[model samples]
Target chain A: MASAPAQADLRTRLQNFIPKLVLAPSVAVIFLFVYGFIIFTLYLSFTDSRILPSYNLVGFENYSKLFRLSHWTTSITNLAIFASLYIGISTLIGLALATFLDQKIRGEGLLRPIYLYPMALSFIVTGTAWKWLLDPGIGLEHTMHLWGWESFQFGWIKNSDYAIYTVVLAAVWQSSGFVMAMFLAGLRGIDNEILKAAQMDGASNFQMYRRIILPQLRPAFLSAFVILSHLAVKSYDLVIALTGGGPGRATELPATFMYSYTFTRNQMGIGASSAVIMLMTIAAIMVPYLYAELREKK
Target chain B: MTLIKQLKLSAAVLALTATTAAAADVEVLHWWTSGGEAAALNVLKGDLESQNIGWMDMPVAGGGGEAAMTVLRARVTSGNAPTAVQMLGFDIQDWAKEGALANLNDVASEGGWDAVVPAALQRFSKYEDQWVAAPVNVHSVNWVWANKKLFDDNNISVPTTWEEFEAAMQTLQDAGVTPIAQGGQPWQEATLFDSVVMATGGPEFYQKALIDLDPEALGSDTMKQAFDRLGVIRENVDDNFSGRDWNLATAMVINGEAGMQIMGDWAKGEFVAAGQVPDEDFLCFRFPGTQDQVMFNADQFAMFDQGGTVSEEQAALASAIMSPSFQAAFNVVKGSVPARTDVPDTDFDACGKKGMADLAQAAEADMLFGSLAQGHGAPASIKNAYYDVVTAFFNGSFDSETATEELVTAIEIAQ
Candidate 1:
């Protein structure tokens, strides 16, 4: 009996060790490659590095310069606007799509791929395609003219003031479907009995969605929000492909600014400092929510 | 005893194999990804190959050379650098200061580079009196490329002054055509601004404002006049011009939607790609004002240091790049004048010949100035400030007076 119990304990220990062994390499790779390079970049930011990396420390000179640049300021401002609009609009539209699709709409199977396919393509290609489609003279306006609306003007992408919104629209188009999928999955997993009980109490359709369904979908909302926020904060390929931060830097974003400084201008120290500031800004926005989630999980 | 003999024999065989495989593969990085640019690069590649050298091309496609620089910087920082990189203006100096470039003094002297290349080019290509980069071709940024048929149909001749150009544009606009094909991108805006500045303010004021970063010059009445001229250009462009690509703008002129474009000689490549011949389908002229001056920026290949084990093949490749045959062959396809003044003009087009003649004249008169596009004239900060003010004026953000004021402010800040 003692030998049998000892053998069972050994077997349990071996099973537990197998999963850790399987996961260890990937976890180590993430730490060494992703986290390690981030720390290295952070260290470079504090130094007066230029064309090549140097260890001559300059404290916060680079950061002060970054703050002084109008491009940097404009980029950060654009980033804030982009993140809010993209997140708010995408979430609402995604929720609506998911909810509507949950009503057992005809052709739901075909429509799901239609919504999700934009996410399947890279943002660069999407931005290029959208840029052409939204171009005033060549695309929508031209199509409108072909239909005899000669005075049509759909040139938002060309307008300096409205260009960033066009970027937001394209981004939303690409990512809303992803959020829709998450919401759909969450909607499908909800208990039918709860909804039946709500209906039994004579709840209105809108009230049921507002009071019961939305509250229950909080986890999915949080998940979608975090994903969209990450995309917004680090958005570079879209801007590069669409506008190239043009019309006199009106549509410039933090990532493009960092890129221009680091590469074109060869101001690595300033570039690294900007990167650090971006990282800190992202963390500041996300840390509290992450902490709350982790605490709740515990 | 038998095992030891076998090991010795294998070691001898390995050494022989290594010696046979010692050809140095020279990796060259460039930003020429367009069809014409790719064709131009093939000439250089062929020249290098003929020298018994292996050429590894790393081409990144972007109009401004920004993307390629990003990749090059990463490679250099990671202790892995290409043997040569296509660089412009202060980029050479910036890299040279980091001790990232190899000293090409011997190569320059052997090629007789000093006599053939201009002194201004030497200023950018050398670091502390040591040759760091080899000049390939000179691109003039102030040429007015126009559709000859449009000009003929409108009964308009090439403009000789800023006022004449504006009137010509208005004439074209009235005839139901887009007058100026302007790319709304900042660099394109800056290019147009530079052309106007040279045309309106002349070389002296341009040098003071752009190269010297003189606040007074930036705020001068003449500079204001330049901005006003740019304002005219802005108004002449079509409403849907914003965010338009340079090639598309060229296409506008190609398809006869626009009458003219103020761009660098590289615009000729687009014309050539569209099957347009110089002086026949389209014509190239220096922007109005015979004394206006030509702003020149060269594309140079700066050799990076590869330590003591620098391969013989890379040395051969570098030598081949500076050869007269390569200069003539590459520049012919590149739609720019050869950097070497001694190269024969037979292979050049009519406009290219004119460019070469003007270059010689400018060289003699000392009218050639550094261009902002290539970053030769000023520090990056000051250049960007100039760009900011120019772009602001171009985008109708400010009037000419306000632009001049902003220009002075920007210059002062940059200093």
Candidate 2:
């Protein structure tokens, strides 16, 4: 240690400084754009900003007004329905497909990509394609009628009562394949010896899988739930492209509400309040999951 | 002249040409990307090109400039405002209030725009006694485009009152035809509401209920009747109308699948594009009781205040927009009447001629009013508030009385 002089110590310090120098710009950008804008939006929520951002504070007025709107209540109710269905359906389908693939089925590689194809597409494309397919006049219903099935009726997209489910259907179609890949990876990581041991103990396929295999996929389920909940809370483009928050604001989500009020409706204060609420929603879902993840690693 | 003097003159002329070529071109942000609309904009672009002014086009398309407005907000907030922007009524006023719009009084006076433009359009063009925007075209929302064959087959003359219109629709429905080709969008629903309010309550009551958002007017029996009329129209629309685009609804009328569409004059371009002649293949009439009244929405271009003053290019662009010749040429292709009331109608079609005449008469009689559905009668916040109530009423979420009550409450909250 004494042989190491000031020159060596200085060189070591310079080497350590290089990594921070490289990372500083990105860190600064994220802080300014992500956290700084979040703080700014939070600040604007308390102000009476309209059409453009103003700084005149009118604390909690926007929030109180937001809660009073039936439109906001409708959006929150829709979020509850969409998130539950999207997560539930996607997880079930993913697990089933992953289990099927784990059976060492034929053409696994070909079938895997085919199953995952929809995930590769952007949500906008999915929304648009689903919109056409679900339209009664010129899409599936039209084709069915042309096929001489005159009694065929599938107009869920047009029905305000079932429109949110259509959003869920498209979302599930796009994401279930990704979830399958997650489960497939998790299933493959399970030790082959454990399965063989269960079989030797005379455990049937259903019992072994139900008691052992399903319980082992906890992390996958947790991750999927966390990911889907946030995605549901922030869903904007799919609804806009598919339903445009209509046939009478039936499919309006919080993100669409925020964008509409801020830009189209010229109610920036209400928009900002809605946005802050959405961010807090995401944080509520993500923070506990992240904290558990880090604590587990420790 | 000596050789040296001739060379000096030639060099000076070359320098002048270079500077003119290097002059900043006007960058215009607009949402006019449809086929006919783009062609109409080409007329103005060519006009500017003729005067040695270059045009830098910035086109964004979606939701009738809603997406474009979002992009404009981002640009202006970032201090990269376009030289000019295509704006609607209160949007120009909103931007003017923000002090982001240029004062075009210099160009306004030079072109003598005050006398030619109608007062209703001028209401949007000028803010605080200063010209902030140039009126481009006027679109009236009270027109019904009906297939002539269907009307003739149904033995219905052009209905001139509410009872007659309802009777005709009932006849069409009995014949197993969809009576009204309506798109189930909030804005389209509100457009129908505009004509209905004007028809059911007359122009004066419409001014009070929609324009002024008076509590008494909004909650009156007249408002309830408007909702009931909207309910009648709703029953005539097909089940497949939900999430359908406006053009597709127009196509339904053109293809004989539906009887009529109550829409703005923009739908005329669709008929024209389909090679359907007016008063022949299709007939355009003012909604039954709205014959004497016009519900109008005008497109305008507001110049942004770059460097705290209007650039020469911006002034030239604004001047060209209001010129009688350009207005005529543009509106003729654009399926709208000229914003300037003095423009000649020789180039207009049969329907266009009717629109022009109706607009002039309505203006002269003080019966012309802005369309609330199209963001001219009120600001966006209030207009959107009306949209929620109107759509809910049309979709059976609210009865007429509840709709009237909701309308009052919604407007008050928005205010």
lDDT string for model 1 (B1-415, tens) is 9999999999999988855654446788999887667888898877766766667778887766767877888898788888889988888887888788888887778888888888978999899998888888899888888999999999999888877887999899899998999988777888777778777777887788788877788788988888877888888898887777687898889899999998888888889878889989998998888444769889988888878433566556667777888888888887888888898999889998999998988988889988885576876656666777777667665679987887776556444
Query: Across residues A32-150, which tens digit of lDDT does each residue of candidate 1 receive?
Result: 99999899889999987766678999898788777766667779989999999999999999999999999998999999999989899999998999888988877888999999998
Task: Tell me the interface RMSD of model 1, in angstroms.
Answer: 2.6
DockQ scores for all the models shown?
0.42, 0.59
lDDT of 2 by residue, A108-205 (tens): 99999999999889889999999999888788999999999999999888877888999999999999998999999989988889999999999999
Candidate 1 stretches with Cα past 4 Å from truth are A1-29, A293-298, B1-25, B219-224, B243-245, B272-277, B290-292, B309-311, B344-347, B379-389, B396-415
Residue B359's lDDT within candidate 2 is: 93
Estimated TM-score per prediction?
A: 0.89, 0.93
Error of 2 at B132 (Å): 0.8
Model 1 CA lDDT for position A9:
97
| Residue A127 C-alpha lDDT in model 1 | 92
* Best TM-score among the predictions, by candidate number: 2
